[model samples]
Structure formats: C-alpha cells, structure tokens
Target: MTHASKTTTKLAEEYATPIFDHLTGHDDALYIPLLNHAQSQGDVSPVINLVRNEENFPYAIAHPLTGIICLLAVAESAYWVPIDRIAHSESCSSCAPIWRDLKNRVRTLKPGETFYAAATTHSPMGETRILIDAEDLEN
Candidate 1:
C-alpha cells in the first residue's frame, strides 16, 4: 500500500465531494441492514485479489477510483468495513447494494473528468494513490 500523493488528494477531493455528499444526504437507515450483512461475512479476500489484478477486473483504470468511492461510502455510513477492506472489496458482489451503487455512479463520470484515490495499508505507514482521468477509461 502507498500514501495518497498530493495530486491524488486534490483530485479526489474535487471529484468525490459531490458523490460523498449525495450518499451521506440519504436516509442512512436504509443502509444499516446491508452494512450489518457485510460485517457478518468477514471474508473479503476475493475482492482484494481482483483489485490487485486489475486486468481481471473489467473496470480497471489508472486510479483505484472505485476503491476510493467504496472507502468514502463506508466512512460516511454505518458500513462496518474498514477502509483497507472496502478499498480491496470494491468489486465484492457480496458486500451490499451500496458498494455496487457507488461503483455504478462512479462509472458514469464523463470523459475528461478526473479523480484520485489512495489505498493505505493498515499500519497507515504507506499507501498507493492513483489518479484516474476519464481518458484512462478509453483504454
């Protein structure tokens, strides 16, 4: 894992603000059940594997934007998943509707739009940051 670079942090704040606001504004009660469900099923290895192997994940981009979205969502909600767990589990189907919903919303970002994401290790000693521009999606 690596820390968020300056560029990544700036772009992430710019792009993720609206999305995070939208998610947080909703009735949080609706997400409690799903959060609880994900908590109970603690195994997230599969999702981690996919994140590490971007080629295996269809939505791969220059940045781990999806993981960042997942991190933000979990942070704002009652989702018990840790940041590290959620970062890797962005593609985890068993997680909940919120993860998928966030991913879908992120996918809708228009061309030229850009964002940054940082996946930090549990120790907080390191993190990996990615800068995702819409153009990266074209490849």
Candidate 2:
C-alpha cells in the first residue's frame, strides 16, 4: 500500500476506542477505527441526536465500509464516548440496507475522501443504528 493509504486518519487517533472480538460483518476488525480512518476532516455530521447516558436509549457508531459498529456516540457529542465501554453486537439484518448503500458509494469515492455518519437505536420501534455515507455526507 502507498504511504498515504497506510497513514491513519486523524479521527481515529482522536476518537476510536479499540475493541477485541466485538462481532462484526466485515473482516477481522480490531475495531471500526477503520470508519474514522475512512473519514476525512469535517466529513461527518449527526443526522439525529444520539444521546450517551444511562437514562437514554442506546446508540452506536456504525460504518458501512466496515459493516459494523465500533464507536458509540450519543447524548452529547460524536465519538465522545469510548466504544469499548459500551456493549454492542455486530450489524443486524435490519441495518443491512445502510451498509449496502454505504458499500455501493465506496465504489466512486477516492481513498481518504469524506463521508457522514451517525448511530441511533430503539429496539421497541425497530430503528437501526447507522454509520458511513459518502454519498449522503451533506444530509
């Protein structure tokens, strides 16, 4: 790989709390810092408020490129919480469309390009967590 490809993104360095054996849909990801690495400066913007706290509903950081969630940013800010501290499973069938769409967009984007991401879950209502969207970065 080229040196640029080997270089990690700033987002992963600042956020991305690595995980071990956390279930995922993609390759053997030590974690989805790949999502952050995939992210570019000023790329992500929250679509909804993912609150992080005991009292609130659960949310996680997901990326279609990795096809898994590695970070949980909720309640206040993005990637503000260390993902390892949260308990989350791999991607579910319900959220497959999100991943599929993200993967499709990957075809067009140059490496190190930007994407938007977010995560929110409400099992009772059947809402799925999502992350990674190069095509929908503006939304």
Each model's TM-score, in the order given?
0.23, 0.31
Q: Tens digits of per-residue lDDT for model 2 on 19-106?
A: 3223222332222322443556542322223343476534454343432343444322334223322332135343344345445555
- Taken over the whole model, the C-alpha lDDT of each candidate is 0.33, 0.37
Which pairs of residues collide in candidate 2? 50-74, 50-75, 51-74, 51-75, 52-74, 52-75, 61-71, 62-131
What is candidate 1's lDDT per residue for 9-107, written digit by digit as tens?
A: 456456545544443343332132222222335532222211222343212222343334433122221121223223223332343544554445446
State model 1's lDDT: 0.33
| TM-score, predicted candidate 1 vs. hidden true structure | 0.23
Assess the local accuracy of residue 86 in candidate 1 as a C-alpha lDDT between 0 and 100: 35
Clashing pairs in 1: 2-127, 2-128, 3-127
Highest TM-score scorer: 2
